[model samples]
Target: MTLPHVHIIGTGLLGTSLGLALRRAEYPVTLSDQSPTAVRLAADMGAGTAAEPSTADIVVVATPPDVAARTIVAALDTWPEATVTDVASVKTAVLAEARTLTGDPVLARYIGCHPMAGREKSGAIAARDDLFLARPWVVCSDEDTPADRLAAVVALAEATGAAVVHLDPEFHDSAVARVSHAPQVLASLMAGRLKDMPADGVALAGQGLRDVTRIAASDPGLWTQILAGNAAEVRAVLADVRADLDALIGALDLEPGALATIAGLFAAGNEGHDRIPGKHGQAPARYSSVTVFIDDTPGALARLFTDVGELGVNVEDIRIDHATGIKLGSVDISVIPSAQVTLTEGLAARGWWVPEAAIDTEGRE
Candidate 1:
């Protein structure tokens, strides 16, 4: 039997990412976008062929929330047999608009979905085949949804190696508003405040500032639409955060241990932080450090890895810290077990640079 053809509307990041994943899996795929250039770029990126929408077995509307409903409704109207799903961020408004577009209950092919995977970038240029890998994809299925259609959409998620999660539209919006939307707003707002800062002041930013505000580079035009569409839920979540901040501020003027109450609040936050799942749904892996001095040259680390591969000891993780205008850089290789003297000697014999002392791994292995 032949594989079903999947049609994707909008060849932006999410759409093109999904298309590339599906196409890589050898699934027949069709891509459409309002921008012919984007569609062509997606095609070149191995997403799929630029084809008409009527020839698909599944139609995924991967447009922004503002346009998803109309596109989904039109696709369903135009392709009756196709199972329709959307990758919109906001669900409630889109679902309501979609229902309004289709009067008959038979046109029940629409299933609202939001994939919790994206980056600080946009467009087909940033589309990666593995973008959805190990990500949570929320599928909002109502009672009217067809069994086969639900399965097909879930299969699409599985095809991209994503975890499928079922959620009610309202609950989905509220949850995302708390975790995702709020963070985006905070990051962007914080970064915006630094606009007038001196170049030297901004240049003094360290990794902490980079980590916190990395997401601020996201497309403002797209995010403005998303934040506006789900303003109610976003504001609701932000209100609680505002209240917490207000309380913390009030505690600041208190004498010495008079701020114990504020510290207690942070203790609660620490517990919440610990509750988050570790990597790969398992306990977090511990690391032991092996620091090496690298010369400031391209492919130096690659040559070091080639030598390390000869030793047959796997490096679990690695970090490189380069010194400004210095001839040498430090690369810290993290292994599962502590780097033994024998391992160090073997690496040094192969002309690899081993530091006199290794960095501590916080008692981890």
Candidate 2:
């Protein structure tokens, strides 16, 4: 089969990653960006040739949400027969604007897509070919879209090792508002609270703080475009969050029924968290956590993983928490209940520190 040549516009993270993945998949890829240096960097990283394809079979608009519609329209006009798709996180607004800019015939050649994969970091420097692996690549196609065009876009998405999900533009926007967009807003807000804190106060942070604020270091200009583009849906989700925040504040004021309200909120949060899918989009499964203290040095993590691997225990998850006052890191290894005992015992026998609670005991878990 002749692999379709994919011409990617915008040599940022997504575009470069897609180019790398397509090139790895034996699909001819051409890359371009407004910044010459950016496209050159992507090309240097073996993503694609730093040039435009004369005849593109597929044109990917991997620009920001604000400019994505214009880019999509331009791609449709540039390559009349090429299937054009955008990887903008927001779908509805981009699709709406693209439809407004061009006629139905040209617009039918364009499809709005969102690859539910990205790191907090941006740019080609952070691009990874395997970034889309195991991530959901949402395709917002309508009845009016051509079958061949849809297939081409889907094939492009699959080439990046992403699982394709078909969703309408409106639903994709609302769904992302709840899952991704709102969470980013919340993380930024919570991280901002630390800006005014004293050095000592900030130094006392733990793993929980790190987890919440990890993405807070993202590029403000890029996120501004995303949040602005999906204002309505994001605002709706934030308004609901605001109501919950108001309730929490009221409870903190020691009003009547305050305890019940506080308890209900936490309980509801737990229930909601429990509903989240497990790895590979499977149903949630409970796991036991085993905490191990290690010296803050290189090879410590690798040694721990090697130990676990030697024990033949399957680890479900891992979290590292640096000790505040000491040069030590606490590693929390989560595994199924069945493997918890085996892992803990194996580590303990290997002279690794095992917390009393994590160790196998006849009386308790």
- Residue 216's lDDT in candidate 1: 91
**TM-score of each prediction:** 0.82, 0.91
Overall local distance difference test of candidate 2: 0.88
- For model 2, residues 231-318, the per-residue Cα lDDT tens digits are 9999999999999999999899887899999999999987888777777487776777888999999999899899999999988878
Clashes of 1: 0
List model 1 lDDT by residue over 1-365, tens digit each: 56678999999999999999999888999999999999999999999999885568999999877988889888987888888889999998888777777774745788889998998788999999999999999999988888988998898888998999999999999988977899998998899989999998998887668878988988889899989889899999899878988878878889676479698889887666555544555555555677788888999988888877877878767778777778888887777655545557777888777866454544332
Prediction-by-prediction clash tally = 0, 0
Scored by TM-score, the top model is 2
Q: Which candidate has the highest lDDT of all?
A: 2
**What are the Cα lDDT values of the candidates?**
0.84, 0.88
Query: In candidate 1, what residue range of length 10 has the lowest lDDT sum?
Result: 356-365
